[model samples]
Target: MIFEGYHPLDKTMFQVMDEEGNIIKPEYMPDISKEQMMEMYQLMIQTREADLKALMYQRQGRMLTYAPNIGQEAAQVGSAFPLKKEDWMVPAFRELGAWLTRGAKLEMIYLYWYGNEFGSYMPEDLKILPVSVPIASHLNHAAGIAWASKLQGKDEVTITYFGDGATSQGDFHEAMNWAGVYQVPVVFLCQNNQFAISVPRGIQTSSETIAQKALAYGMPGILVDGNDIFAMYAAVKEAFDRARRGEGPTLIEAFTYRIGAHTTSDDPKRYRSDEEVEKWKKKDPIDRMKKYLMSQGILTEEENEKIIEKAGKIAEEAFKYVEASGDTVLEDIFKYHYKEMTPQLTEQLAEYKAYLMERGEA
Candidate 1:
């Protein structure tokens, strides 16, 4: 049985494996087959490789300033893989892998980093919100969507991804309060990478744990080893089940480390020590998952190499496709905001078009 009230806040935190790669609680394990687990392991590796390659592309000036999801691969991939197609996902800037798992195209993601607004284009029925860069603002949107689904008697759930720093925002508390009051079907997945930019977790909040903060909201708050795929998946799956069963919202604090800079624009080396980074590197999610797969005899050296090579090739092709797509058109910017442009905007567009014409640049 899944243990309850293990944490002081009475939140049920279940972790199957420890940092040393030992399975501590086999009974609470997910019902996934070994083959499936290996497949997920491969996917996680592919995601890591893709993330690294994308970062390199950004450094080479091929893409816009990008957020690296290097250390949070398990948190993103494991939690995202269990989500159904009907479930909606609202993500922060550092969720490219989760976005990809939710049916987002690599080409589209590349276009997004290449500075195209149309990169937000998803299929009409795909249940994904556009990337929210304004921190915790999307938490309210996720709660609202879940509340609407509850009102309409739809079983669809919504999951919102944010960082540890986002928890300090008023919007986060408001969203949690509303979700708790309305019993909305939402999961607040906070990937606590331990740092909000240069600020450490200790400086961000006075609370002992981010998960415990959910106690005041009258919802279940789970803390899991974010680097462990099994733990992340189990926590998220349980939360999703609770939401679907109309048990209101669940807050999940995935305790992982941010291995790289906050983004391509910021440098972590200035504030944090290399020793600290090295410590987290030992618990690398990709390496951990690969080790588990190897231990289970589900993956071989040749197969792993082939998987990485294939993902690299795909990443390269996506880069090529994005580079060939050219720059965004000036008119395209006027198309998204409103169905009909206001008089002021119309005048502005006309003036811009005239200026372009005068310069023979239209």
Candidate 2:
């Protein structure tokens, strides 16, 4: 297993491909066909296009706050590609790539960012939870879902994504401890994108690596090159296999960089240096995969251009669909929280409506 070889304490990271897109560890490489690999790369392209468009929309004030998944596409897409339809994906807000991998519509993602509750409505076949914003709290929910699945003898595995800062939360420890005790089938994927919204990873915890924390919880952990899609796919595939074999949970810290700001509202220049950003840009995951695919004759310059152009159009149309959807109903905000509106909520809604009427917005 990759976890057995890449000890979290030693801090020796696993890599399947180099920054130049050459496979360094063919032994650990996944057995996916070249065509399938090309598809994964195209998915990454589609995801990047959507992310860039969403940023443009947010900047234009056409959408609400959105978490950008610019540089971490490989980590998100590779880990999610191995998941079966029955598997559950619990996402933090920035996992646009993972959501797409798990069959989420681009329009739904745009709708959610456009301030509509229907964005949270998912297809019946997909088990993805809506984007969670409260840091590491969702890990507990992932553990509980796994526990329930185990109790019912269901063959479901849960994978949850969080950032490096989330590791500092008490909920992180609590969930890990419980999952360890119960031996539930779950995978903890920490993107570890170097910073948690301007806070450096160095100050997040004293531990050398986030993956090592799994040892204390009695589960295996591995640190993989998040920029190398092959390594991410292989490591996550091994973890999911271990879970299905009833070997309990695994922790995978994908050491990648966030090339953009944490969210639309954040400013990366405030805390990080341009030199640092430029250095990591050399290790861009999407570029690495494209190089590899082109070298293998799977993608040509023209073919790649077509993919990008098509994906750009798809993203453009998805946002147009979201924009064409009329404004959300005023009652939606106060009604979904309970079976019936509470007296206080009813009064509050009335006041809000009256205020909107005064402003000609109702």
Count of clashing pairs, candidate 1: 0
Write the residue-wise lDDT of candidate 2 on 20-54 in tens digits: 98998888989999977987898899999999999
Clashing pairs in 1: none
Model 1 per-residue lDDT tens digits across residues 1-362: 23253452654556777767678888777888987787677677767877888899988988888888999988998889889878888888888768767778888887888899888778867788887899799999999999999999988889999999999899999999999999999999899999999999999998878988888988978788899889888878888888899989988888899998898999898989999999999999888877777777888889889989998898888888889984798877876667788787888889999999999998
lDDT comparing candidate 2 with the true structure: 0.92
Highest TM-score: give the candidate number.
Answer: 2
Evaluated against the true structure, the overall lDDT of model 1 is 0.85
lDDT of each: 0.85, 0.92
